[model samples]
Target: MDYEISLETLLQHLGEEEPFPYGSVTPPIVQTSLFTARTLRERNTQQGRNEFGYTYTRVDNPTVRLVEQKIAALEGTEDALCFGSGMAAIASAFLTFTESGAHVICVATAYTPTRMLLESLLVRYGVQVTFVSGECIEEFAEAILPNTRLIYLESPSSLYFRLQDLRAVSQLARAHGIITMCDNSWATPIFQNPHALGIDIVLHSASKFLGGHSDLLAGVVAGRKEHLEPVRRTRELLGGVLDPLAGWLLLRGLRTLSLRMERAHKSGLKVAEWLAAQPQAAKVHHPGLPTHPQHALAQAQMRGYSSLFSFETHPIQEEQAYAFADRLRLFRFGCSWGGYESLLLGWAQTESDANGKASWLFRIYVGLENPDDLIRDLQGAIDALTP
Candidate 1:
């Protein structure tokens, strides 16, 4: 729970010794479909035993449980469950919390897939949802209805890096007896803990920061045991359990999480500051920078910043924006981030705004690259944009 001492130390050693065999430094993969008990009675009662009483890998496994425990500790939760993908975890949470005719309030800028899930899928199930700007707690308050069952948040949202007042929204949800869930992939546990800020559940696309490398796909949900029991049941019934190898990779990723995050935080701020100074960059949307609208709120809630952030460029043609991205040497054109390599994604509004100008927006993920070198790469791209 204590971010400084306990969490940092837990990442290094938590659950490693007990799950591993013969004092193996790294935990074993536990790569098997089933585990047999010595007696019929034991096999019959495995479900009643503790969480580690693994009857099948789909239900539980030592390797996956180890990763779950580490994430639970890192997020300061009573327990956690791992899933095959981020959307699987999100779907399980949404499925477990709401029933037909229930109403939900979600941030407008949550992950695109999550929005699609709510808009495209859940609506078919008779669930109603309202999307709010999330910058103002009043928007969530005003959107709440008598049938509202949940409120979803994504602070420092993926594209704009906009932040919501977690504590404020949590308090509002508690007053309404509504459950609160947060997508914390943007600010990994190393930077922010939504549960500690009063959120009921914390979700992550472990494929990003948690995996550290782009080699694995996994998701995690962490909260109190009671709140997570239903989710765990949903996970089991849905069959979205993480595979053994990905769990092993996540275990390896956890070891260096702290070091990687520290580098990302510093480098991200440096690059954002430089971008803010550029004439072509209309605005930089990094919470770590004081220029950010919610910088003070971010400081009060999060101990650190993530590498991913977005910025708006002075009005430019869509082709020119693409040209700038194509010119970058260090930052790759990719959809995912929080890995070893920097990435760039650019888009422009198809229709002009009230001012009859369409500004291009770009999301940048500052990786483990040297700040100076990345900056030069960006400068080169900017210089070549007009040509």
Candidate 2:
């Protein structure tokens, strides 16, 4: 048996096994709040254990634990912990590691909610943070405070698609005894392995790729057993642990992740290349593009690309962006991606309009569709946008 089996193979069998003789290939969802032990002594004995112990759903559940174990193995991590949402996993990792006075260095173009959590909530609690471009390793080194306790990264960053040097940053963090974490949702394990680059913690918005459908809201954090144990304990204490049904769904979604991701990569590149060649397009950002500043780094680190990417166009006005978006028939307007449906999000009202944080740029998630048809659709949309 090869430990390094194909992702398709791993997806099929990762967490679907049953413990009993029911002969059910699919793992049953243990939907109860609590479990009963055969005896008090037996319960006490089981409580002393780790994976096999399952006293409560919030503390741990058999179904959810199986998902954790499966993801841990897939990520080449010692253990994993699931959460109600991606933010829960992210916030818990911070809370578990950093105290009130600890410092963190983060990317400026991070996920908006994560930025809010760091700036508003964490700063209010005495956890100071520094934001940087995250393009060069030296930026991270320059931002490090004496009390810096953690470093967070999101490669091919949210809006700008800025790539970070994970190995360099991780090495710097390790030298200073600071914990390193990256949101791995964008790359997934199929594309990049942050752990292999010496990152201590890896986070995911399972609601996107891991779930492989737009229906579920879930998250997972993977890392060494020592680092993740505290996060697991904190999750148990905070009551943000994943439920059994979501775990089962996630397990089911991952069954076709490898296949879905391959198609996504192919379609993504085709779309990006098409966009790059368009006269109306101002810029297209994707790691798969050779024109991307960090394309070489991405090639060195990742196995494949995903469909989620962004682009810009010469709009007559902000309204043109929305007009272009509305003209498209195949791409539905949606907030999140990694599902089977092609989606697009139009730019929001500008910061000048409402003193908002900032306006959104055009973002697209290329679903499994014909590349030529999608290109045709995009061309018509762009044509309609010009005044």
Give the top-scoring candidate (lDDT).
1
TM-score per prediction, in order, is 0.95, 0.93
lDDT of each model, Cα atoms only? 0.89, 0.84
**What lDDT tens digits, residue by residue, belong to model 2 across residues 232-333?**
889988888888899889988877777888888999999999888877666788999998989999998889999889876553466566678888988998
Show model 2 residue runs off by greater than 4 Å. Answer: 2-4, 15-21, 44-52, 348-360
Task: List where candidate 1 sits over 4 angstroms from the true fold.
Answer: 1-5, 45-52, 350-357, 385-387
lDDT of 1 by residue, 1-387 (tens): 445566777678776545457767887789998887777776667653333576788788888998999999999899999999899999999999999999999999999999999999999999999999999988988999999999999988979889999999999999999999999998899999999999999999999999989898999999999999999889889999999999999989989999999999999999999998888888889999998999999999998998898888776666677778878889888999878999988878446666555687889999998999999999888853431
lDDT of 2: 0.84
Query: Which pairs clash in the backbone of model 2?
Result: none
Q: Candidate 1 local accuracy as lDDT?
A: 0.89
User: After TM-score superposition, what is the CA distance of residue 71 in candidate 1 from its true location, in Å?
Assistant: 0.6
Task: Point out the worst 10-residue segment of candidate 2 by lDDT.
Answer: 349-358
